[model samples]
Target: MSTLGMVDLQVNGFGGIDFNKDDLTAEELDHALTAMLATGVTRCLPTIITAHTECLRARLRALDSAICNSRLGPVMIDGIHIEGPFLSAKDGYAGCHPKDAMRLPSIENFDYLTEGLRTPIAMMTLAPEHDGSTQFIRELISRGTTVSLGHTRATRDQILQAIEAGATMSTHLGNGIAHMLEKNNNPLFAQLGEDRLIAGLIADGVHVPPYMLQSWIRAKQASRVALVTDATAAAAARPGTYTLGDVTIERGTDGIVREPGSPYLAGSGVTLDQCVRNIMNWHGYDLATTFCMARNTPLSVLGKSAIPSVGDIAECVFWQQHDAQWHVTGARIGNWQVHINS
Candidate 1:
């Protein structure tokens, strides 16, 4: 069997690096990319959460330079995933993002936030219930940007409308919600039933329970499910307190990251490599099927080729399962060959 390189579409920060911060240097960005590479993520989109306008611009510019300068190499930073400032302002739905920064979805504001950046914005996560969001989704799709519905309180009708308007994915389904929800009428069920939307799941076993994860996979099927880590700065860092944007979060020994003194999760501490293992263990999937969910599904949704054509020498990762755990023992990216167990 041929190996497949993993791709992560929704990652905020990793290896003690926060992409939303204003002072993020190129060196720190390089370090974060290297950490991701170690975990078998050959391609990724660095996600930026909700923040002030100027702050967002600064961060975007810094990231643009980091990619253009070859700080992490040519193919590591495939694109950028802008997650907020256009999301719902509801309490639990907003998660740890600054409530004051939330805004109605608009292309003008998006243009302002991403001004003068040469890096392509691959996807944007927003609340589709907001006025003009449907049109905004169409506009983004026109410009070759994928729109994902998330951080929302949309009705079932609104979700369908977003899908009709070219929203093709969901950011971290089963998350960005309050502990309590209306039993039947909710975004979770609405998204699950929509076959057009490719759902992103964080299978760290903490974000979404095993039963719910199994249900989502069954509902959406493996082909339409993309596994993402949604990892924060705490990932690959020591287990302790760390900052995600402006919020302080603590990573416990259990490997779950949460807001200080609260049960609400800040983000994930697990890497994508760990997510693959968890999903396989939870669902009893074969290694090939698991890799397709993590790699092919996301690449297809992002309008990228899922695999190398016949006679092409594509970069890939070789994995070995031991004691019910999956490990990336080697990887080849273009001319680069990385050996993990040598």
Candidate 2:
């Protein structure tokens, strides 16, 4: 079945627009949203990565204004995902975020940005190894936000502690940290081994291979997996140089390619639609499973209250199969069908 709507839970930025950039006006976000919709993403969590506290606070405030005021043209702001500032300091697997400001566990810092949001935060990524990390997880859980593990070097026991403390998710499982203790003792295996926790996968083939995605889906069945763009300013932007936080990301033809000197993927350039495409084409997964990974699973991540509905600030898009490809047919906001293609 070709589903009509889709949801993307972890998108950092799009069309040269970063959620963490203070200069990224509402108009730029609108442009990004428009591009996302064209690719079949109806709802999304615009993620903000770990950086300077002031920069993080400013981004949160800007997003709050845009969502409350509806300042971004035709785009809908579903919520936000604060990726980090508190994570492991390890070089390779911790990814390409700024190292200086990164801390382990700081509840005071978590409260700073969450308190500033006008809309709810869909999720937050934190490492369990930091001091008071468990307490921070519980606090975030009580506030109705999903806590995800990421950019961490936590041991298996530590991950279990975080999960028990209310951290029931993982952010881009295989992309975060590269070096890990062998066997099932690291975050990747720890997250994959648990049936209760949900993990977001890139599914772009570049970030994760087909066999791994297949194995993950088979291991967790259909209910525990979700797709994330992890997109940067280069998501829909043409191949060129763009910025993520304070770093420079150069986009290439095969999608956003990281420099040779980089450790992990610099930042994702994949889109929600492309992720769906890969699951179907690369891994040969069924359409229903792809839709679930791209939509329903993420909805589950938002908890039960904020789930999609006809009268509750609904956002969705429709597509129908046309020959060998899927073509966008319609888009809606609440009850209004705002855009229609063919």
Candidate 3:
């Protein structure tokens, strides 16, 4: 069967390359995208995580240059997903992101970070609990950016307010929250129950336990659930040390990416194909539903048209399904095509 090309809205890095690197190169970007293509991902938003304001801008400029100069980046990268600098700074909510860099959301800060960039910020993940986030989210929406809430401890009412202000998505739901929560009243339930918010889930099993997947998907509804890989350089690469921005992280043989000696997950090592397969195999889902969550739903969240047919676009993946197992037989992007195995 043929399906829309997999679209990952939150990819940090892949293979052995770091998208958050201060001096990202075109060759490195191509290597990462090529590795991603083998797994049937035809497009993605290269994510940039938390850093100091000035350093973050530098990273953005460097990444913008790599995308413009790289062979595959022009076709593979949809835009940038900025995930930080405006997140919950307290303990576990901060996760692997540096707490020192976290701050309240502001338009001036956004302009400073995104100034002079060739590539646009297609999406941003920020905490809505901040004082001015309601207005800030409105401003971001006016500029054509998709706003997603994450790393937050906002009350359900605050989340609703942000949604009212045009925030339409949640970044990596079921993760990036306080270590403990009120079982009856929490951000997780708020996002899961909100029909207007399309929640991004890292279906890598490590991010959210496998047993919880079915319930979370059910709570959010399949159509409003989109798959994402909050990947670091560890993704699609062998078990080893990799860089996540300025921090050095280790991908154990177990495939968990974390800052050295820290229990908090730095990012994910799972590819988008595995995410789809995991959902189908874990639950009784068919490929159609899972594929839509991975591709069409995410693209829709980014304000892009969904794939109505296999031939609707020049980029898509040809799949061979045998019971629960699925593999990419071939992938096409623009004029480029390649055959591959799982």
Candidate 4:
């Protein structure tokens, strides 16, 4: 059946190409986009998590150059998702992000990181409880950037304040936190209760359990939920060790990516299409509804429109389900049509 082309707003890497690197090349970026397209993702925002200031700058420059030089341009690489350097420095909550690189949120720092970059900074993931984060979130919203709260130890009140200050979403709502938290009060529950905020959930099954995923969807409602891969370079690659930012993570035979000898997840090794299938099987959602959560919800949060009802030139994907897996058979991305070999 045909579905609206998927949009991934928080992809770090795929097809063995890590976007969170200082040495990312234009060709490698093109190959990554190709890999994503082969899996039915028509557009995406490449996410860069916590890193050194200069490193982030260099990476942003490289991505901007790649987008400018790419044949796909905006159709493939729509924007950038800056995930950190402004997250919680607390243990467990920080995940695999380098603590030394973490910093308090500031508009000046954001400006320095994004300076001279043509690619739009579509979204940012930051801890709301950090000093100056409220103003920074407001400023980012004013400048047309979508701000998301994540990697945080913020209290319920703090989250509400961030939402009041213009934070519109939660980045990977259930991940990026410690193993233990108080049952009633936590970032996850706080975000789930906020009707004004949309939540991005990594439905790769490894990031969140099926029951928990179902609970999150029920709390946030299907319309307020968006599926994200939160994928790392190990995604679509063979099981082995991979690097994200400077941390070494092992993708075991079970397909779970995590820090060596630690239970902390590094990132997901699943594609967005697989995430869609997992969500469908876990939640018993139909193809159209699942596509809405995978595609339209994210576009809505970014202030973009959904697919046209009566357009021949619409971006779309042709896929079929077999053995509980969704496979892309063909796709029309922008003006281009891609056919996959069976």
Candidate 5:
């Protein structure tokens, strides 16, 4: 039996550090990477959520430096998934992006933010409802960036139109929009009903229930689904006050959620390793399929040709199973054992 390795498709912050802050430091990036490697994630898309264009662009510039001349360990930032400022503001389904910062998608805005990133943006999540959004989708695809649908109120036809225009994915598929909708047409179902696109789901059990996870995996199959964390500063930190730039999360012993009086679950405190364990326990998916969903499948969605091949960026993890329970034993970074868990 082969042990599973993980690739996190979305993570905002880790080790009590946040990406959205103007003060985001390269040392914080190293801390986040080290923590992820300890939990068996070899590579990750360090997601930066929607914010003021200038703030996002500034963080990207700093992150580019850390990523290009990496002194960090195995949990390197392979690319980024810039997950919105261009999104709907409807309640119940929209993300935690501030109202002032949220707006329609524009190519000029995206270019400003991603100009200096070393790894380049692998994907961007936006609502298709904004003006010229379809043309924007085409442009990103043409530039070799994968576009993902998220934080939208798009109808089935609208989503299909965007898909036709080369929008290839749904970011955190079931979590970005309102929960209840008119029968047969919502962003969640619109995405679930389609097969041509890949969708990312947070399996931490807070975002989507077990039955929903089963249905998605059944509909899309393992190869077309990617597991994402969408984690924040609380990920590897002790449960307490954590900041995501200007926003704050109150992570108690009960897990992470938004601050007092808020109803939304902001992001997860779950590590990528914990996400794999939850999928295995909740759905009974095969280990190979699980690993592929967590790793190779996301790489494919980001438009990479070859994935995890020998002699090509030797990022891997070694874990042991005893009595059907797995534990991350170690991890690697391009032929070097970067960390070993006792």
Candidate 6:
């Protein structure tokens, strides 16, 4: 069967390559992206999560340089997704991001991060609970960057305010929240109820349990949802330790990535293809509906109009399914076409 190749909007690293490191080489970036393409991903955003100011800047420069220097980077890298250095520092809302590194949004911080980078910051995730978030959301959108709310305990009003200020998305909607919620007013309800926001969801059963995932897809109506890997170096690799920015995360044999001693998830080790299968497995959605979450919907949040129309076979994915598993047999990207031996 044929479909649009998957687009990953929030992948941190893949195939043993961590994009958070400032010492990555062009060859390494190419290797990681190649691994991604083999798994049916054609475009992605190399996400760099929260870090100290200097560390964040250094990592951005290194990633930008590697992308500019790498062969596959230009074709596969849609843009960069900066998850945070501006999220809620609360206990559970923080996820695996370093708490002390997060700060309130600032124009100076945004300028500092984007100073001379060749690759653009296509999307950024932040919290609406911060005092000046409304203005920062406005500034980010004004600069043509897609703004998303994440890793916060923002009330419904706060979320609405941020939406009014131009935040149009939520990152990993069901996963970045505090496990125990207020029952009536919470981040999940606030974001899910707002049709203005397209939710980026990590369908890895590890990040979100299967039953809840089913409900999330149902509530979002499956149309305005986007599937994101939010993967780390542990992704597409066997269980072991990996880097997510400066933090150390371990992927257990169960396929959950977390800090050495923490029970909370650090990042995921799921691939986009696996995620597509996962949604269908958990919710019984047809392939076409599931593919839209991984392909067209994400680009829409970024205001990108590059959706492949009918008969646009120039760039496409060829796949086959066996026993409920989807395998990427081959793909076409521009003038390039090759078989994937997976």
Per-candidate clashes come to 0, 3, 0, 0, 3, 0
The most accurate candidate by lDDT is 3
lDDT of 3 at 215: 90
Local distance difference test scores for all models? 0.87, 0.76, 0.90, 0.86, 0.78, 0.88
Score every model by TM-score.
0.95, 0.91, 0.96, 0.95, 0.93, 0.96
Sort all candidates by TM-score, best to worst: 3, 6, 1, 4, 5, 2
Residue lDDT tens for model 3, 278-320: 9988987998899999888998998888754566447878889
Q: Which 10 successive residues of model 4 have the least lDDT summed?
A: 306-315
Cand. 2 Cα-lDDT: 0.76
Clashing pairs in 5: 93-176, 93-177, 93-178
Clashes of 6: 0
Per-residue lDDT of model 4, residues 293-318, tens digit only: 88899999898887565653468788
Clashing pairs in 6: none
What TM-score number comes out for model 1?
0.95
Over the stretch 1-342, how does candidate 6's per-residue lDDT look in tens digits?
987788899989999999999898999998898888878888899999999999999999999999999988888887899999899999888888889898989999889988999998899999988999999999889888899999989999999999999999999998778889999899999999899999889998877788988887778878889999998999989888988888899999998888998887888999999999988887888888899899889878888765666664356788897886777898766665668765
Q: Which of candidates 2 and 3 is the stronger one according to lDDT?
A: 3
Ranking by lDDT: 3, 6, 1, 4, 5, 2
Per-residue lDDT over 33-55 for candidate 5, one digit per residue giving the tens place of the 0 to 100 score: 87787788777887878778788
Q: Give the lowest summed-lDDT range of ten residues in model 1.
A: 66-75
Off by over 4 Å in 6: 309-313, 335-338
Span of ten consecutive residues with least summed lDDT in model 5:
66-75
- Evaluate residue 120 in candidate 5 and report its C-alpha lDDT on the 0 to 100 scale: 73
RMSD each, Å: 1.8, 2.5, 1.8, 1.9, 2.1, 1.9
